[model samples]
Target: MSTSTSTAAADRTLVTALRERLQLDTGEAVSLVETHISWVLLTSRLAYKLKKPVYLGFVDFSTLAARKHFCEEEVRLNRRLAPSLYIGVVAVCGSAQAPHLGEGDPIEFAVCMRRFSEDALLQRLVPAGRLELDRLEQFAHRLASFHGRAQIAAPESEFATPDQVGRPVVDALARLRVDAGARPTRDLQTWIFEQRKALRTAWFARQRSGAVRECHGDLHLANVVLIDDQLTAFDCIEFDPALRWIDVMSDVAFLTMDLEAHGRRDLAFRFLDAYLQHSGDYAGMQVLRFYEVYRALVRALVGRFRVRAGAAQPGGPDYLACATRLARMPNSAPRLMLTHGLSGSGKSTMAAALLAVAGAIRIRSDVERKRLFGLEPHERSIDHPTNIYSREATERTFARLAECARTALQAGYPVIVDAAFLRRDERLLFRALAAQLHVPFSILRCRAGEADLRRRIVAREAQGRDPSEATLDVLERQLATQEPLDPGECAAVLDVATDAPVDVDALGARWLALSLPPITRRPAGWSAS
Candidate 1:
């Protein structure tokens, strides 16, 4: 018999035996969760994940040995993100007809994990109003740390190369056409194919630069949980390197895409802002929208599959709309917002707040400067303005910032240039770039009482957690050397005092009104796809 045919009978028998093997109390009941790929058995405090013995081209578990090996791999890979949950692998020691839980020659293997309240899952929390933007900010930081420590992809790995990255997108759209009618998404597919050149050139460089790593491939809200009052991720891709080894942004894109699919663009923007602030992956913007569009297609296709199998979910092909919308160049009022301030004046903070509101991609000098020389955002090897912050280095840093902004704005996003635009020339560079692109531009000039700036610098030094290694001396120099904003720049200036708490939304609303007019209706030749 074929693997599929035999597994059906085998799974039925295994389910019966596992129901008994768990040995629940007489009054309690056993619950089984089924999916296309695996079967999960919940037994009070533990969860047993049994891999279906079927071979999908991406993952094969057609034999006893294959199952055992992949079960072990799952525990190892998932533990990095869900450290306290994945217990280990357990063997179903006896025959399927009378499977023993843990004492005989092994017949099959199942991954054992600690079970938590289903309420903790993000999928549940999002609908119950328990998940909030502030909480997602914290979650973004935690996920960034996971990406920081994950194994870098092998030097020759093509998992993140454009061909591999684009393959799943092509496959998904094909499935969508066959299952949901081809007429709806013909334009979207055409757009993606036509833009492949630009997408591949920029994103492929990141892969070659070691940005690809073993990441939590399937990072949708459902695979995440708030265990022990801490947000955690689990059930990572283990059976296929092609799924797990990817650009770090691709991993983040899954969550952002999911949030957008659920009609939570503001929360999605918040998550992306916090994550990018922590990670400093500004240059990843070129790949972000590409992967987001692809991820949306994948989710859309999954929903369609479940429906065909009579698993009609509440949220239908909303992601199809999401994918199509993202694949096309959005009607964004692309604008440039540059930060002008002394060090420790809270430029990054203000920029972060603006990003959450505007959905703009931010590029920070402190972070990007360090990134240029092969450093993590928070890793420090030398003092500011001495080694990496030399005059020449600063020039390179600003140049990098300008290039990144140019690319992101061209790709249809508002851009936030986060730096001390302390010099008129520095501000002019961005101003001219905005003019060149014919986008609206603004300067967010941040200020604080000198004493407040001093106090912040001192406290920042005490903690030593910040990427900006600015000292009081550097701030003094900045104040002295800073060129005042020209009269011509006044029309676009937004002054912000950063020392006290203020409502960001109030300012954001004013800026939005000036720059982005609300869309009253769709333009000509508009189709939902």
Candidate 2:
């Protein structure tokens, strides 16, 4: 038979087999189009994915046995995020012409999954203005929750170390070197080395801190769908265990980078903020930028290779665009500016404004300390003299705040610490730590009139709304003992007055000017809206 005839025959066989496997009574059609590593068929209610019999450098499913194993692996890995979507693996039985779903001898394997609307994908939705920020926040929280419960492989496992996890990225860059010419390749190599060094420390720290876990290896927006008001992440990397077992932040960085690529950076910030609040794994922030850059470069290399290979596949252009975007991920680290003030000074409001510019993690010491004591934010404690506001309790509260700051900083996140900082020693400790870690830090000192503070305290007490639990007398006492920050202590200071419209934008602008280099600064009128 001719080559055309053989190809036509195989196509018909695949169509017939899909009908039998899916129990389709109607004359539903199927098209077996080959992808990079799999064959996908669009069916009425589901999509059947078959692993190709090919052995790539990083992935192998060349043999029938190997294919079946990976088919099962796909089901196992994807079920983590899309349990309801990934049905199971099905065996192709009998002869090619008259193949039955479960009859006769088994010949091939396929992963069966529920078909999702293509438009529901976050990537497509963002461009169409159909993606809601609140939904994205919920999705971020859900993904974080999933990672929290995911299993962490042992240190000896292939997925445990940065080198093992980054092998695919390293290999892709090497391949790109051949076609990118000398200069681009050299620049890419330098970036890769820096990324590897930073990520290695983060990876090991995560392992030691118990933040490494089995996660969705491929978390791009296209893999996520909004179905029935819930975000479903599917199409996980199934061929390699090393890819899937990773620090949770690495998995999140993929989605963050994808969101940024789609020109939805605001949504990206919202997503990261929600995820941090849900998981409380602030330490993961340290490695976020590195992983995002790595993921972007990997996409770029894949695009270059695809263009060279002349594979005009679906998402080819997207891969290239993604790569271009990835090359620019390491422009700068996020900035964090802390704010301290007395009651009615508008520190919380100022911190909230900064969130629009930088995805700032705002940690309120008042609320956290209340949580620690298992008390309501507005609940008053009986004056035990030694229990509620003792020197030891105050020290513990500062320690907790510092710990939270450290966690957020390590996770590659910027943070805003909101507190009174009435003690000079307490303020200096934070400043010293920030200097030691080499992260940019600042302070916004909010001040208002005495009458305003008194009125605000009274209003708060009446509304049963504040965690500070300060009475008029307590406020007066606090004023007497509050030690002013030394001129040399803070990087910047902002005056937040209740009577004036808080110039938060100006404050944020000043903060950007003080901390960020010219290259890292956002363009004029950048909204923290």
Candidate 3:
């Protein structure tokens, strides 16, 4: 028989088995695609993916045992993000004449997953103009929470280093270079090598700071689904633990790059902003661009290899085109905003609102001071004059806040320093730091009437819930000592009154519009990085 005849017969047999044995009543609609290591069947309510008998260097599902193990791995890993969607792995046995699911001896392994609406994917949503910054922010927070709870292996684990975690990428790139010859290969190789070097430092820092953990190794937009107003991340890499055990930022950068690739740079920025705000790991900025480029190259190289291996069908060049587009885009830095006001003037509320709207991290002086003292946020320390809200303690808190802001801004994230900058010296420190970092900085001042301030302080004391220990007496002292803003300080101020409803969103939008670089017009067929 001819090759075409054999292929048609095999596909027909599988389609017939799916209908008769798997109880998939697709009527006349049946499509099947055989990839390098899997056979994907698209059905009405679900997609059944079965492992193919192929041995790729890193992954081997050539044997029945190997296929079954990977099938189980798929189920286990996918359950982390899509517990309700990833049904289970079932055994397919018997002959094509009388195929059965989980019956008799097993001949094949299959993973059953719930089918989501095609339009629900981030890739589709962006083009439709349905993807919003708020939704992306929520997704970012969700991803951060997921990463926080993910299991972190010990430092001694074999998968702790960049070399171990990046081996697949390095190997894949090497093969692509060999196949594509010198020019394209050298450009890609240089890019990969530079990223790998930076990633090494990031990996070690994460290990030391406890950011190294088991994460979603393939966190791209296509893997994310919006079902019933909830975002779900699926198809995590389960074949290798080393690939998944990486810095949290690398995992985030994948999605960021994906958003950029889809022509949604604003959404990508919002996602990164939200994630950094929740995680408080500002050091991630230093390596985000490198990782984003690395991820894009990984996709590009894989797409290239698939075409070379005859695994990908014709029209596969489009996918490679998309990947190349992402690999070539320039990286943009994050914008920064600072908040200045007196205590009880609603700076915290304004800052929190700004965080929600702008997706910037809020570094509060009160909270950091308490954290430094090894005390709860609301705990009051009146042991000595130098212990609680004293000159030394205040200086240390400002320093820490500046450091945190610098780290966050460096990571390509805007930051809001929520502090009562009633003194010129205190405000000068932040301005100088922002100047050194070369990030745009602004101050949001919350001004309220004296009577309103007194009432707020009284209410805070009555509630016993605020982190601030300011009382009526303390408030009076603060007012007396509060210095007028200097010309430099006056330059960055955005006066916000507390008596009326503050349009915080409008304020934040204005700040971001002024501070951030104008969104460059992406060239035709341009992709994100």
Give all TM-scores, in the order shown: 0.85, 0.75, 0.72
Q: Per-residue CA lDDT of candidate 1, range 1-529, in tens?
A: 9967787898789877877767644245667888878989887788888998888887898888999999999999988878799999988877888886687898878999998888898888877778866678888998888888888887676677878877777887877888755334688888778767668887668877778988989999888898877778898899988889889988999999888777777778888877876776667777788889888888877777777788766744388888888877753567888988988888888888877777778888888889788777778857544588777888889888888898889878888899988887677777777766777788888889999999999999999878888899999998888888877677688889998886788867666555522422322332322
lDDT, residue 75, model 1: 94
What does candidate 2's lDDT look like per residue over 443-486, in tens digits? 87777888887888898788874566768887777788888776
Best by TM-score: 1
**Cα deviation of 29, candidate 2, in Å:** 5.1
Candidate 2 ranges with C-alpha deviation above 4 Å: 1-12, 15-24, 27-33, 100-104, 179-185, 195-202, 305-336, 341-353, 359-394, 403-414, 419-425, 432-441, 445-491, 495-507, 515-529
Top candidate when judged by lDDT against the true structure? 1
Residue-level error in angstroms, candidate 2, position 95: 2.9
The TM-score, computed over Cα atoms with residue i paired to residue i, of candidate 3 is: 0.72
Residue-pair clashes per prediction, in order, are 0, 9, 1
Better of 1 and 3 by TM-score: 1
For candidate 3, write residues 92-178 as lDDT tens digits.
778666666667888677898887787898767877888766677778877888887988878777665777656766665665567
Q: Rank the candidates by TM-score, best first.
A: 1, 2, 3
What would the C-alpha RMSD of candidate 2 be, to one decimal place? 7.3
For each candidate, the alpha-carbon lDDT, in order, equals 0.81, 0.70, 0.71
